[model samples]
Target: MHPGRLEGRYVAVVGPADDARDVDLARAEAVGRALAEEGAVLLTGGHHGVMRAAARGATAAGGVSIGLLPGSDRAAGSPEHTHLLPTGLGELRNGLLVRAADAVGAVGCSWGTLSEIALARRTGVPLVLLDPWDLPADAGVVAADAPAAVRAVVGLLAGR
Candidate 1:
């Protein structure tokens, strides 16, 4: 469970942090569970909404969950996070998450999620969109359903 080891595949689950829809949360949870089943470590924003749900799903599946918190207070992170990183960088920490991940799966749409997607594409990290933005095919973003997002990520990482 060493966050700095960089030995295992890391997947960042990016989405909104407040008042997320139940359907979106469910999809995020499924993505997290699927990533865990594939033995990929889960990373999230460590706040509420989709991030919390994804972390819970990963932990419930006996997988590691790491939180890159925007705030300085470690206690502000979701309870499901196994490792808390107090970045204190606000939304700018999104770049760190995108860079740390071998791949990224976005569960729902939001300004923050869009930023993450853009960062992933700009940084050459495989980006999987689950019920998120509809980017052009040439944008290098893979659009996938909740159940297929994990497979898409694995395939993308393998090809890279």
Candidate 2:
């Protein structure tokens, strides 16, 4: 990636942190890596589980990973994140996360992920779901895996 391809693009990876399954974590990690490879910046809740895994993957790819924390303390976020923005907005920070994203890759299902998904849909932001909840097709395009999900999101962003 020339970086300019997605210089200002932000892709949010939303999923369960504490309750994330191993499979979800793996998918999230792969998603993060793929996004980074395409020059898209990765965004997450910035705590644990999928968030931490995605941040780690982004870092591994030499990409930027921005963690948006709900706490006032920046140190409360995951260490893997290259940058941390402590919102102190608590759960309300979900809105900020979704709003900041040019697209969203949801690796798995969770209450928080659901909120993010809904926000994306309501705002008409492109959304890609991987091994997530049984959402309606109109809600978003459900991809078979991480790479496919990233592809779908990229296509959507390109207005394809």
Candidate 3:
């Protein structure tokens, strides 16, 4: 990878869209902020809960936030998102999110988040888990805390 490879690199932040705990949302927001500080473009499912929090953080930090909406209505996406792509693919859009990202950061545990993680892993995209699910050691997923999420993701991206 180039020395400045992380700059403008798209990193997807996957987590619960709804019913996420306050702690989880906070962690995701911090991860988003850190990624923005490191010059990463934040990408999410583009709805509520953790996604909203992450987008808010990225935008607040003067960074770009992109959302892949599950529905055709772009207005359904969070206002914090700098750009919204209405895929109209519903949950299946998760695959696109993983494919678009150079690396993925999982903030919280959820069925959708797990699916994203699996997709990233299967596609050989580096994954950084933040207070989330655990796969086998051989899965090559990087485990990190909320504060370390960006660094871990950047390291993975650089390795690639």
**Candidate with maximal lDDT:** 2
Instruction: Supply candidate 3's per-residue lDDT for 62.
Output: 78
- Candidates in order, TM-scores: namely 0.90, 0.95, 0.92
- 1-160: candidate 2 lDDT, tens digit per residue: 2553455699999999879999998998888888888888999999999999999888898899999999999989999999999999999999999999999888898999999999999998888888877888799999999888888987888853
In the order shown, what is each candidate's alpha-carbon RMSD? 3.7, 1.4, 2.6
| Candidate 1 runs further than 4 Å off | 1-7, 140-144
Root mean square deviation (Cα) for candidate 1: 3.7
Better of 1 and 3 by lDDT: 3
lDDT against true structure, model 3: 0.85
Question: lDDT ranking from best to worst?
Answer: 2, 3, 1
Q: Which window of ten consecutive residues has the lowest lDDT sum in model 2? A: 1-10
Candidate 3, 1-160: lDDT as tens digits? 2433468699999899777889888988888887887788999999999999999888888788999998999999999899999998999999999999999988878999889988988999888887766677755455557767777787788767
Judged by TM-score relative to the true structure, which candidate is superior, 1 or 3? 3
C-alpha lDDT (0 to 100) for residue 119 of candidate 2: 96
Question: Which candidate gets the maximum TM-score versus the true structure?
Answer: 2
> How does candidate 3 fare on TM-score?
0.92
